[model samples]
Target: MSHEIELKLALPHRALPALRRHPLVSAAQKLGNAVTLDNTYFDTPALQLKARKVALRIRRQGRRQLQTVKCAAVSSGGLSQRPEWEQDYTGAFDFGAIDQPEAAQLLARHHDALVPVFTTRFRRETRVYSPREDLRILMMIDTGEVSLHTPDGVERSAPICELELELEAGQPLDLIELAETLASDLPLMPADLSKAERGYRLFLGTPSTAVRAEPSAIDATQNAVDAFRTLAFSCVRQWQANAAGALEHTDPDSIAADFIHQLRVSQRRLRALLKLFAPALPATFVADWSVRLRENANRFGDARDLDVFHAELFAPVAPEGLADEASFSALASTVRRAREEARAHACHNLDMATQGRLLLGLTADLHRLTIDSLIQAADLRTFARLRLDRLRKRTRRLAAAAETLEPTRLHALRIGFKQLRYAVEFFAPLFPARAVRRYLEAVVVVQDTLGFLQDVDAAQQRLAAWVAADARLAPAAAFVLGWHAARYARLRRRALRESTPLLSGRKPW
Candidate 1:
């Protein structure tokens, strides 16, 4: 991912499942024998800035197989903005105590919580015929001092804790039995005071923030939002990587087409993100920018979709005609003509000197725009209005250009159609997403009708050339050409009627 990544492990109070104690439930139970450790964590300057965490932790659990979970925290000291929020991400690592001494010591040094029970693992494993304790592993993430006390009797309930164990059906805690037992026998009870959590430390209650008389839900929505954005950024970055590799070689068609696909997906993320987070951001900011980016993106999308499909899909069907060969020369000829038309159109649409500049501008904008800024702008509504206007204007411009012949007008009209559809999509969400979905279907109808016709026209020309390259299929080539001409006319008529600009000014949303 191009964006920075931060991981934290947390068990929020709201996320806990409801608790019910059965007749077998023990007021005080024990984990027969298990592994235990005592540990603490700290924060450094760089780790604090990047992870928004000042402290780190590693906690160990289990006996025979020896499993350890690492946890980290961004203390309020490291967290500067939105004190109510904290970020967390988690993953698990296994330590092999059976064979490796290094793994044991490493666990001893880094692991903290449940250290007191480390010695119990041997006991738990030693029992030959007993059922395994349904132990659970969990972490509690508390932003404020959350009260676990019951309102009726003032008995404290466990708060801000996460427990993990693959439970059998209807059995929630083999581990809870152990926890309750340890609390009863030892001086430790569920910690009411809040402390920092880390890759290695255990904390409970209110974290660094002051405790509240009444607790509020942990607002990790911002963190969730950022994680999603980071993921989106990664998708776009893949295109950047592909586009870079394409630059290294000389196959313009393969390279340029892949780059365009990446561009299209990148634009899609922009579109979806704008819609998804519309509630959180300013009205039209994501929409307006979406329109602008779509303008450039559509030019590539139209040309490349056709070009790439033909290259990847049809090449297998007519490999011999690809160049000069003994292969099905007629089929190869047809494909070449189609490829040339689409490629020339995309390349010629922009001035030679400025091709990279226009493409880069769109990608750069996506990279630079911040999630916070997108929300603060004209907002989704106002932005959508502006985007629609821009798209409508562009569509009209292309409609005018379509007056010209074979390739030039076709090229211009392609650009117009892309921008117009995108505008409609931007507004589509304002109505029913289902209705917007229907509009996209109409778009496909137009493309299929027109696209089929264009395929025939170009195919006829290419097939004729293939016959010339290798005369063996001369008779078949002639038959195909005749079929293409008639089909081409049919498709053209369908396209012209379907894509009339009558709805261009309508309230698309």
Candidate 2:
């Protein structure tokens, strides 16, 4: 079996012209051949192969055919390293060359059940660049559509436009350097979803949905930088997966709303994580990405706020006479229009040339990172505990002064609580499950309480702004603001009271 290490990027068709003219592609070691590739992905009727994370595909290029099998791979920040087996196709399926025992045995047992599920027909333009004698990167620009064919002769397809950078041979940093250089000019965002995965989702007719945090695979023996990469990449995957879904959906009320909310949550998680681990990371790197993530969060802020307004605030309280049904409907319509416009603006901003470059640069930076000497030799548990303890002390101080704190200070305290909460979750897998749960339960109570108060504050501000912008909305906005004013104060008090348990709870780790 051979290992495939590559970085994949997804870009818009509009980027193709600029990318082709970029120095990295135009002045390559060799301008390689172009070909039309027709690929068909195969799976059992019950998707047995998919359950095992095994992918089987046959590709036809001109008169030649190649069959390939890819097993479960560790993928992060669009970079993947997987055990893959490939060989010439002799008009039939072949598992003889697959050395991975699990994959070979499974295919041998279920070979008869395999059937084509989806196909991708794309034209690829290839280029090879050699930055040094020992390093070579194969770059390809692919344009086409992934299609699923029905037994009734119907076909459904989604457009596919991407740039792939595969490490032909060399150190991983070489690949990072090449990608960073290319991203300096072209719009390229590191893509987490593989074409095969996309095809399977299309074939299965699965709607995109919010993705939760997967447990970090950090171990006690790992370095601090390694642990951070694992955690940060987890956040990146969550953000990218949702961003793809949000950008793909054209309808405002479709899966895009859930996707946008999840994307924002992922961004917050990443930002909090960076802040928690900033002491160990390169300062400049942390600072740059911090600003980028915050900007991204702001881009989605208006739309997400509007989403909460419609789902959580207005819909539930409409019967309390804030507005008549017709008037409420009119207001809802106005909100919906504003939301669609906001989403569109956010999407356009995300699709801009600069955003893609930023994403690619971020990916390259992550790949290029190495543990500093101070952190490399340190124990992960000790490192994690030190950060957690510092956060806990800060949180306790904030909670102790909660009632007397100004609004801005209270907000800062809430943010501290949030970071601590995220840090616990990020490292939860390394500690005892029950102990972690007990501590988290108290943290959640405090965290959610603070979140509610923040929501009320935000809603009041949003209502005031809306009414200020349009005098016609003044009456409805006034009623909404008045309805929440007393409740906000009561909730704030409760939130302060709830902080006692968290401030006093013992550390689980």
Candidate 3:
């Protein structure tokens, strides 16, 4: 058994020429001529192996056949590490080489029921990248398709074009640095999906959904620095997943708005985590990444704002009379055009190369992060309690100021509530689950109310400009604002009222 450590990157087919022209690729030694590999993955009808997160495949290269068994991969930021066993396959199935007891037993029990589930055929161009004596990486460029043969005699397939960087003798950071170098000019995006994973998705016809923030796994037994690293890595995963989704679907008109929204959420969460864990992290790391993540997330802000304006604000407003009908129709047209333009502009700037570089750089830097001696020994639960207290106090101050109903002040208070909510969510795992859930439920309500208020304020600014540009839009804008006037006032009062108990009550942490 051998542990495989590799970084996978998805390359646009159009970028193949540029990748070939890259200096690093040109300088690397070609292992041999490109070869074709045909691989068949096997599983029982019940998919017992897949259920256990194991993969069994047989590969045919020329006249030679080899069987490989891979355990579940631990992946993040496009890098994966997994244990695999490989041996010559003369004819029948073999689980003898698999040293993992659970895997071996599972495979042996279902050996007779195993059947071909999916196949991948790709031409792989392998090169040896040896920049120094102690460093070596295998750069393999693959382009082909993964196919599934259904019982009904139907074949489903998806195209595959990727670059895999297998760390042969160097640190994982070296592989990422090399990828960053290549991505500087190529349309390379770090891909967390393996061919086997892709094949399974195709076989199962799984629809892509927006990735949300996962629950915090931080425990009190760990040190503060380790807990922060764990949380930070989860944020990176969310960011990378959404960025990949946004980049994959290039048509702005048909793109899922949730992708852009969730990408921003991930960035905001990371920024919040940086503040929450600042004491345990290096000052420079926190400061630099906070700025970078904020700038990147802001690129999609216009699109998200327009989406909310169109969906939540405009869509709910109905024409009450003939005059409203005509004016509202005109306003709707303008809003649609602006929304499309914003989406297009955001999509245009969602450059794969830029995003890939940012992700890889962050991942590498995160791996290199070191804990100060003083921070390395601090109790995680104690640190979490202190941070949560600070956030709660700050939010309480903001809530008090928000009572004046000043738009700017209210917006600031909303941001404060959001940060506080995120901090609580991050530290919730360290406290009693019931108390944390109760507190979080209240935080979300206030945050949601404040968020709606902020949206109304933003919409007013945009609508005012539109109204100024066209007198016809003035009545429509008035009607829209008037429609939400009562709710906005009520929510404002409710926000202040609901936040008092949350701020004054027994804390979760």
Q: Which one is best on lDDT?
A: 3
Candidate 1 off by > 4 Å: 1-377, 400-405, 426-431, 457-478
What are the TM-scores, per candidate, against the unseen true structure? 0.37, 0.92, 0.97
For 1-509, candidate 2 gives per-residue lDDT tens digits of 89899888888898899988898788885554788999999999999999999999999999999999998877766778899898999988989888888899999999999999999999999888886788888888899999998888877898899988889889776766676677777767777788998898888788677787777677887888888888888887887777767777755555367777888888899888888788888899899899999988888788888777767666666445546555455556677787788877767665534545655567678877877788888888888888888888888888777777456656767887888889999888778889988888887887776776676667777777776776666667666666667867776778777777666756698
Question: What lDDT does the true structure give each of the candidates?
Answer: 0.40, 0.79, 0.89
TM-score of 3: 0.97
Q: Which candidate number has the best TM-score?
A: 3
lDDT of 1 by residue, 1-509 (tens): 01111111122234323211222222224345433332223333223311432223333343222232222222110111111211222343233322334324444445343222101101111111124454323321123222222234443222233222222221222333333332232221122112332221222222122121111111223332343344344433443333332333334354355555655555565565555445554456566756765675676554665564455334424333333343445455556665666656555543211323323333334334356554444344555556566655765666555644355466455545554564454345445566667766777676565555555555555556666876775665554445445655666555555666434634445
RMSD of 1: 22.4
Tell me how far candidate 3 lies from the true structure as C-alpha RMSD in angstroms. 1.4
Worst 10 residues of 3 by lDDT: 318-327
lDDT of 3 by residue, 401-458 (tens): 8789899988998899889889988888888899989988988888889889999999
- RMSD to truth, every model: 22.4, 2.5, 1.4
Q: After superposition, how far is residue 128 of candidate 1 from its true place, in Å?
A: 48
> Which candidate would rank higher by lDDT, 1 or 3?
3
